[model samples]
Target: MKILAFSDLHRDKDAAWSLRDAARAADVVIGAGDFGTRGEGLADTFDILRDITVPVLVVAGNHDNLAEMQAANRGWPHLHVLHGSGVAIGDTAFFGLGYEIPATNEASWNQRLSEAEAEELLAACPDKAVLVTHSPPYGVADLQRNGRHEGSRAIRAAIERHQPQLVLCGHIHHAWGTKGAIGHSEVHNLGPAAHWFEI
Candidate 1:
């Protein structure tokens, strides 16, 4: 399968437009999140991306409002706003967990989930399903500008237990475009750029 993934667009129209063009060639598109800042204007980015006819998977980031994001593309047949849910396309299964896992002090509007909450949500993920999350798993692709690892231990445990083929995530801007690993799973901290993968 051909997968095109990007994250942290943060309402960049040019980036969204570029991804629209790139999506033409992808069988599936993944938007890891933070389409807008502070829960505002996320619909603007989703508007451009919704044009793609392929299966487009999205998750809410710390800066996003899931209800707003879902409302934006309410009945779009190709768009799937996944949070604590899973979807299957062809033979591949995908499970997604949105928000800042382990919590954050960024802003009042920050969407967050405690480690236990995340664990409960992630426990339902099927083995080998593609794991899509807003925050990277602890100790992998999650280093901050201050050299701190601001990731979720629950996410890490999920990777260790399920070993998803690919784990896609974003949120830590400084770690964007970086890569890491957990067991056999590949993890990418994608930024607002077209990242292509074949599985």
Candidate 2:
């Protein structure tokens, strides 16, 4: 199926508009994360996404209010919020864990898990799955402005152990691209806008 992945739009309507149009033409659209500005304007933020014509699979980012987001998405068949959940789309099975690492300060939400907890989530998915997370795993596509890598050690370990088919994520906007593979999984970070690929 054709999958379009993008992230960190952070409520940019122009980008959302483009994505909405692109999404309608594709089989499915995946929003990696950072969909809204935290601490305010949630109602309006969801209004933007509610217009999407195709199936939209989203994972909450550090910038979103999960409770509010969950409420907003109620009864929307086209939009599935994958916050610690999995959804199937044609030939692919999409599994997601949003905000699975802790942030140092305010303006972010972190939910880091132990190796066992990580494994339990991975175990819940079928082998060779399409995994999605807000933050990229360490040493995969996670890079800082100075080229330093900042990602989850546990996440990396999970990928090494499970060997998922493809991983789609975005938390570090600077590392807005793709890394051929990490462990046995191919990793892609679609940040700051829209991108499409055949999977």
TM-score of each: 0.97, 0.87
- The reply for model 2, stretches above 4 Å from the true place, is 43-45, 100-102, 106-123
* Candidate 2 lDDT, 1-199, residue by residue in tens: 8888888777787777777776777888888777776545545445666777677888877777767667766756688888657888877888887764535334334434544565566556666778888888888788889888887776677677768788889988788885758766899888856777777
Identify the leading candidate in terms of lDDT: 1
- Candidates in order have lDDT scores of 0.93, 0.74
As a whole number from 0 to 100, the lDDT of residue 100 in candidate 1 is 93
What lDDT, from 0 to 1, does candidate 1 have?
Answer: 0.93
What's the distance in Å from true for residue 199, model 2? 1.8
Look at candidate 1 and give me any clashing residue pairs: none
Q: Flag regions of model 1 displaced more than 4 Å.
A: none
Candidate 2 lDDT for residue 29: 83
lDDT of 1 by residue, 82-136 (tens): 8999999999999999999988766888999999999999999999999999999
